[model samples]
Target: MTDMIERSNTPVRRRSPGDPPTVPNHPVGPGRLRVPLLMFGAVAVLVWIGIWIGNTQLTHDAFFPSRPGIAGGTWFEGWQRWDAYWYRTIVREGYVSYPGVQSSVAYWPSYPLLVRSVSWAFPSIFITGSMVTLACGAGAAVALRRWVGEFLPRSAAITTLALFLVYPFGYYLYGAVYADALFVAATIGAFLLVERDRPGWAGVVGIVATAARPAGMVVAVALLLRVIERRNLARAACSPDAAAPGPFARFDPRALRRRDTPVLLAFAGVGAWSTYLWVRFGDPLLFATVEENWGQGAGPATWFKVRVFEELRDKPLAAGTIGHVVQGLLLIGALALVPRIIRRFGWAYGLFTLGVVGLALVGTKDFQSGGRYLIGAFPCFAALAEPLVSRPPLRAVLLMLSLVALFAMAVAYGRGTYLA
Candidate 1:
């Protein structure tokens, strides 16, 4: 992933045939990150204030009433809606279940566990969870910028970060007390570690990712694809003439060497959760089973029965219809970038985008939570940023639209209205 960039006014130095290949001095230091970090911090602050104002001043009929003791005690209580309630519950009382009912098991454990760990000091699940989400969101921004910088110019990386920040549903990454912020941080951090050729650390991060959400499994699969790519590159380097292995080439056990074994740890994260469920509830895969209680079941039957378009046609301006449209457009846009992402980044990223979109589609009935889920498909944003880097007007328009939608969604979320 390393590329050499010659500085302007620096003289070119020719290398001898025997000279070692020049290694790049790619230091991702404060000097390189100052502007983007400040910009991200500013946007985060604005989002916090915006949500506070919306929750305080604006009023709407709450589609889903805030749960008791879940939201509405503080200025930032607007963020403690929907899934935040589940996380807060989990923090107060560990995963509990009633027969044939939706339970805390449906929500993954890492984020709640983290919130609980810090709750001793913060003393408020809502505040502690919001702080964790904010911290993870900042980490995601940094990791995204540095990862994009590996292949693209600094301006392009900054644009990508900007795009991520204003990405419509990106408010979830700001002050929302949801697991998504941690999931994105872990997912991108793992990708960056893999790009830096640190599989062990990547696996460790993947553990956090997998423990954050069910979609976190995509990180493990993407890392496996990257591992295969590494093997193919190594083979090409060794043979020089032999054709590289096909993308679907037969599995080679030799590829799973000591360095690569850490990838198994990704599954271990989820595996541990399953074991806990088995011991506590006598069902190891209770998470998947409980999803049916939420009207989400994954299968070919589910895919064929999608009614998003029908909903749009019948009630074009309904809140749920609008959510469907926004998520549908984002899914289409991401799908459109799959090929370009593979060409620009790698197979892992392109396919990871596909996997994320696929999961979002199949995992929901009316694309519920689809928009929030697609935030994990960071590759699509990078692919978009590349072209936008040379088109300022287009970039501005996109950002404007994104910001408008972001504020609208923030207000909706603050009002306890269901939003993806």
Candidate 2:
């Protein structure tokens, strides 16, 4: 379960003393890279097909009503929901608001800034956003495949990417207007670098990731914990007869000195954004506090009653009510698997996944965005997909559910529904 990289193409060559383990030795030849490239292409096609089908549907049953022609467009039509409009607004017009109060501060700046920076030459922000999102979605798949390949066989890694590509609510990542795709791409890339024993590069990628979404700050903790655990494991392996006190083993702090600097740099990503918010809005926590405006509170307890059971009690058969209840349950179910993930992968991965669930739990009304939030917790998906790797029938069943649900969710999203 806690296997390290050992691919045939990237054979684990013998290392000299005091040297960091080498990884990603797989050559970038056409024969080596073809599978991942094809996987990326396949994800793009599925995302495109979903958007195409969604464009033909009417927006009558949206989560919030939208006027005709407002959500329609030649490209990425109806993909712009409530939040997407705000992101576009931020990109087109810098963070200016009328009067004293504005909702624009609720969103972090990384994604809009990226859209503006990357699309400087393009006139249409929508086109730029869509292109960026699609590209990032493919990048995420490629990064995820590489990460999985570190532990699983090539065929298993490909199947894992395929599962993620069609994950029910995962289509949101491929949308032009949302930042989830970019966030996932950056996050997975950072972790993949960490797995390759490249913490400096991981930290660099993590900065962009943390700025993309507040939940992404957990990457720093993941890196820190991984470094500590890996060093301790190395020590234990080197000294099999070393005695430890009581039930716990001690880790040498000096072993982590080199790793800590880069991990701290990754953590600076959160601090940098907080500073930006404070300088711009006079409140570093403005983005977080704004969740109250959406009727969300800061804790798992806030979701247990009013967001779920109460809604069900008040409107037993209403679609929204049932949907909320189901999503809330799904959130709980995903979180329920964390212990297993930890036991299988190691404490670092377990703690990181726990942080993801914790972030998803707090600052929300319910598990409304649970599915989307869990997308950032890549380990959960990997753990879920682990057993099906060798079972063709089980994998097929999963594929069927994921594909059907993916198309259905994409249609819902296109119609401006709250799918996550």
Candidate 3:
């Protein structure tokens, strides 16, 4: 009985420096990139099916229709909808405020800027944009694998990546017009840099991330946590005694200066962009404030608006509200896993996920895009994946359900029925 308990409680071992990496507990050679790439291909197939269904079955009356210039109208127009159309407009016309319409100022400039430059050489801006997202999304998967492997074994790391690919709302990444794929790539790369103990590079990558989306600013919490953890580790190592160290041993002024500078620089990158927004639009936070036009605002009031009797009493039980409810529950579940992430990963990763989710929840009218927003909180995926690593049957069921929901969401999004 004692031996069985001990065996059951034993932790899985990771590959040593000399040992070759494996895939899903099998010897698959040192280069384990093929499975993840294959995973991406599978997701692409699902997305294509969803888009095809929408293009054939749905009416375009209320849909944000794409113009005939792209590929001479051979391509399906279902992929261009909601915020995607705004990105296209911004790329072509630049930011301009229109009466009653959401301000183009609300959209960050980085993605549209990239789209404009890439369009110079490509046949179609939409095609070029899709290529950009695919490339960045692939990079993000690679970086995410490395980060997850730091704590989990290679097999678990792969599972986590798989989970991310099939995550119910992951279809957003496939939308070429959405900047989320690039944002994810930069954000994951920044985290990977911190894991490698390269603070300066982390901050450099984090700057690009910060420009990708407003939620990018929350990464500052992760950087700060990394700085404090590193300082603590340095002080503990330098101490003469293991148990009780002197005051001098508890703090290191030199290490603080060396490590904390990069974090400040990263934050300054975000500040510089905000300053640019202020100069151009007269409101540094117009990006945030513009959410009001969409009925979103800061604090609990935004969420409470949906609950008021007079507000939603006449509102029908439509597809949009249902999608929001589904996504909100998913986001809450992910948020609830932060404590487990802290225990399994570390302070920086867990706190980063927590801070990002909390910030996203605030000033949001309804949870319409909560899933896509939470997709930026990558650690939540890791935390959710950890327990299912060894539970093949359970993981399989979860993946099946996720894939089903992904299909539904993809169809809805393509049909313009679920704009969020």
Candidate 4:
């Protein structure tokens, strides 16, 4: 509650001249942006409607999280299946049964810890957490738009956000209170920091983001990128003799002195989180065992069982269902478009993509929706925008159709329906 409530309790008085802007307030300008802006607004409305629908239908009368063969407090409200339920327990009570039989359920902390802190300041932490999740998704979109804008023409940037809003899988972020929103925001924010040459900031965000669901593993790529960039510069400057030094090597120690900080940060971040895994339960290496005791092993047979059985083996119709099939296709389309986005920005965001792909693999089973598992790749919207509307009248027509599909998908997603 501290994290969410503290911000809300602070009244939104008009900013003082000395104050910094709270958010990306101010319209994205007028004419060329009008349609996209309208579409973004529609995205917001549909998300609210989705929450309303979920609150009305999904709130449990006595929703207890049942960890097999273990006895404890179970029921929470609103968030009951998949990661959310276990997370709620983690927030309420610290960490337990983690490294032993229930190891698979001991998540990375961070988000649940934030939830616990926020619950302290709120009347109903459940509702507050859900809203916080929603806000996180919206915030991520803004950060993503800013980062993408660096490469895209202004209109394309705005269009990128619009496309994200109406993406067939986009609705999942708001459909249930999941980590997808926070992960998206954090991963994109990390990219923005790296793009701005703030590797330190990028590293910190990566640590926190990955803590949410171990999805922040993608952020490590950003750190790796910094290391690679430094190596490239040093290699170009190195000479054949005299300790293999070159012109700048004899004088400037800028790239050489602390060339490995980013790499160390990467290890520190992953190691620190891995340490949390050990400290909380025991075996720092084993991420989650609760999911495993109930049969979440990563062996070929278990993997085959999940792939063949295809339904929610662990929980209800959460991530481990046919829902994942549709989501996978959506992810495929998103990945295919990444190269175009990198070209537009003249930057390589492969590390971010790597993290997304890695986390998707770690999911043990398919994730709930497109927005949940792979959408956090961050650059995909910008990439997707290109294939449809790169040029003129015909492209514009394609863009219009995409916009229609986008909004329609947003609405349909909110309604929780699927077309075969």
Q: Which candidate, 1 or 4, has the higher TM-score?
A: 1
- Estimated TM-score per prediction? 0.88, 0.86, 0.84, 0.67
Q: Write the per-residue lDDT of candidate 1 for residues 6-72, one digit (tens) a residue.
A: 4444453432111112342233567556765787788887687777666666674465443445433
Global Cα lDDT for candidate 3: 0.70
Predict model 4's lDDT versus the native: 0.54
Query: Quick one: best lDDT, which candidate?
Result: 1
Residue 345 error, candidate 4, Å: 4.6
lDDT of each: 0.78, 0.70, 0.70, 0.54
Q: Please write out the lDDT profile of model 3 over residues 1-420, one tens digit for every residue.
A: 999999787654432221112332332455556666677778877886796576557665365553555561423455666777778788888887654557887887667877888887766667666667777777777778776776677667878888898887787777546888888888888877776667788888888788878877887657756665556544554443443223233233455665557865567656877898788777788788777777775656785645433334555476556666666687788789987876665556677887777766664667667788887899888888878978999999998998888887777766666545
Model 4 per-residue lDDT tens digits across residues 1-420: 788988677544332211112342333556334544455556767555543344344432233322333221122232333455566677776676634466334466666666777776655545556656666766676676766655556666676776676555555444344566777777777666665556667767777676666655556655455434434334443422223222233223344335345533534555776787678557676664455674555676544445525454555465335556556566566566656643443234644565575545544454333345666776666766655555657656755675565445544333334321
Name the TM-score of candidate 1.
0.88
Give the TM-score comparing model 2 with the true structure, all chains together.
0.86
